[model samples]
Target: MSNLQQQLNFVLEIDRLKAVYRQAMVKSDNNRFENSAEHSWHIALTAQILSPYAEDGVDLQRVTTMLLLHDIVEIDAGDTFAFADQTALDGQPEKELAAADRIFGLLPEQQFIEIKSLWLEFEAAQSIDAQYAKAIDRILPLLQNINNEGGSWVKHGVSKTQVIKRNQYLEKSAPKLWQFVLEQIELSVEKGWLKPE
Candidate 1:
């Protein structure tokens, strides 16, 4: 097949993820359901916009790649929240690996390898770029919850302690961005977007 055809096939494969939307148990300003694809796009854009604020030097391109591909696995595996325990993550790896093998494998050989590597790297959160990408991933949900007036937190009966614990990874991985989240959490609590203890 021609490169265009291969690219087109790969792009079409991602449509499956769009079918896998998660509305955060909250809603956006438009009050629409946010799909996994939409979440990935927001994270990619955030990574590009927030790259400069990274606590350390970063490869923006790598971060963007990680953001875009990280959740393609959600196409098959579904999204699990940060507050969920390890029990939820169980079996997710196998599901996601199967999804990645099929979806990313749609691309041409080199493209498939590139995307798969980025996906795995993001999952590992070992690389500098992966760390920042994970930070963006976590930060966006917190922002959404804050904006939607305790969307997921309220639904899950998540405590402030749980919120802090769930998002604490941000501090070590991306201090500045994590600090911003802390500030927003404080403001959200004060404004009643979050319930006080």
Candidate 2:
């Protein structure tokens, strides 16, 4: 196939991401669960808007790109709830890596390598860009839960301690955002949205 055909095919295949539902509900859409595609878009925008607060010298464009491509693997491996226990998460990285290989392989060779590299960088969350992107990614779900009266936290019986432990990395990537998260957790607990233990 021509490069154009390969690119177009990849684009068309990724449309399936819209159908992959996540545990978090859309805050503005009543109680509807958010899809992977929407989650990607929201986090990309969040990265852009929050970039100024990221570590000095962070690349906003790369962070946005990482956020945009981070969840494409969910199209195949499916969405894993953030609160799932370790048993439920076993082998998820391998499954997602396989999905990445297949999904990204749909692109032309060079494009595949570049996109896959960005996805891997996001997964590693080591670089400044990836760290900022990851911080923004984690923020959106908290905002969704807070807006929807603890949307997934309530449904999954998640506690404040669990939420903090899961997202503690945000403190290193975006200290200001981490403070905001802490305040929100306290507020959520006060509102009876999240368990206090």
Which lDDT values do the candidates have, in the order given? 0.79, 0.88
lDDT of 1: 0.79
Q: For candidate 2, what is the lDDT? A: 0.88
Q: For candidate 1, write residues 1-197 as lDDT tens digits.
A: 98889999878878887778674743634666678888889889988887777866678988887888888888778887666778987888899899899888888899989889888988887777888888888888888888777787776766666677667657766788788888887787777666666
Q: Could you tell me the lDDT of residue 135 within candidate 1?
A: 82
Cα error, candidate 2, residue 81 (Å): 0.2
Relative to the true structure, candidate 2 has a C-alpha RMSD (angstroms) of 1.2
In model 1, residue pairs whose N, Cα or C atoms come closer than 3 Å (at least 3 residues apart or on different chains), thus clashing, are none
Q: Where does candidate 2 stray beyond 4 Å?
A: none
Worst 10 residues of 1 by lDDT: 23-32
Give the total clashing residue pairs for model 1. 0
* TM-score list, all predictions: 0.86, 0.96
lDDT of 2 by residue, 1-197 (tens): 99999999999999999999988887677778889998899888888888767878788888888888899999889999988999889999999999999999999999999999999988987887887887788888888788777888988899999889867768988888899899999999999989999
